[model samples]
Target: MTNPCASEIFKELSKGSRNLTDLTGLGGIDIFPGMLDLFEQSGKFDYKIKNGNIDPRLGGKTDIINGVLVITLSNDYLSKATSLSVSRTIIHETIHTYLHKQLSYYTRTDLNTFELLDKYFKTKYPLKQDYQHATMSHFLLGMAVSLYNWHKNFGPTGGTLGFDYYYKLSFAGLIKDGTSELLDEAEELIPPGSSWSDIDKIIQNEATGNYESKGEKCK
Candidate 1:
């Protein structure tokens, strides 16, 4: 939780209380290995990095086919992506993978539950057609952690901008008001000053119908 990236803004639609520790729980374990446990009881998880012909226009992609979570990242992005950016990409796809699994599970159990989950995510996340922007929120979140770690270890290597060349290249203008929007959305699920553990508890509550909605959506 002490990781500086834990404080990076995920959403900021409102100015009041926010829960900044949502991603900190993820900081403890290597984000990749953590993917295994998420699917341990459910199924298998795997990934690969494609170098040669990845469309230069694309950064990364995630697919869950026949119960396997597969992540594909461009070689160019791999070569240039900072540890934090890489982690961000992994985590972003992880969210998609998790939501997919939960949606499917709920669908089998009760159609209403599946509909609720679908409606919930659609309101929070951009649709698949807007995939880049959809995941851009997570990329910035990861960059916040990376930038924080960079400062902690090496100090502003990028000079005045506080990040650096690679991070700016990957992120740039994709962050306008995104962090606030995400944090504002999360605040409904998490209370101010909550830790990563608290956020997780809320997610569990959500799955069990213990969580209530304040009826807010990202702007």
Candidate 2:
């Protein structure tokens, strides 16, 4: 039950830098609004944006309950993050919805396998509600940011405007304050193969603006 739309959005967004004029034909953020529309109309989920303090660690979350998928984004995130960064959050939550839906269809045998994996994660990480899947989500966020940086030509950290840049700056500050342990733990779980080095190579290869025709290899 792979989500082709999600895959396609990732592919398009991975293309190199473009301006508003460049957004018209394709390979631009314009596709985002349409994708959101499609997802909403599909009747599989309801989306909500709330303004309030969300858990500082989470910008967005997706929950599937009683046959309804609910995607919630923190109001603080909406108020502070750049449009592109917010779009990335939306994309992240969409993928979560897709993955969760895919898992819900699994047979009991598959459920057993997932339970075993969960137990293994609990034994290995000793963390509650945070483990491999969280790491995978971070990796996905990395994938999204890498694509964004490449496509938008973000300088060093992120474009001058956005939570992406602010988040990186905040990371540095967190380190100075001796509170980066959580960030460090999250960074450590970026799946060995999907390391930033791998993403760097991807950016280098697509520097020539050839990503439009490329298939997603990060997943």
Best-fitting candidate, scored by lDDT: 2
**Which tens-of-lDDT digit does each residue in 1-219 have in candidate 2?**
133332333334323223211223223332334223223322233433223455654556667556676666655444444333444554455545544543454422234324533653567555423443443333333333433443354223334344233223211111112232333444553444455444333332322223431222221
Cα RMSDs of all predictions?
16.0, 13.2
lDDT of 2 at 17: 24
Give the local distance difference test score of model 1.
0.36
Per-model TM-score, in order, reads: 0.37, 0.40
Model 2: per-residue Cα lDDT at residue 79: 41
For residues 1-219, could you state the per-residue lDDT of candidate 1 as single tens digits?
Answer: 112221231112011122211233233532332222232212132232222335654445666646565545556554443433443344444444544554565423334334545654577545542333333333344434443333333332322333322233223323213232234322332234654344433322222223241111111
Candidate 2: RMSD over Cα atoms? 13.2
The 10-residue segment with the lowest total lDDT in model 2: 169-178
Best by TM-score: 2
> Local distance difference test, per candidate?
0.36, 0.38
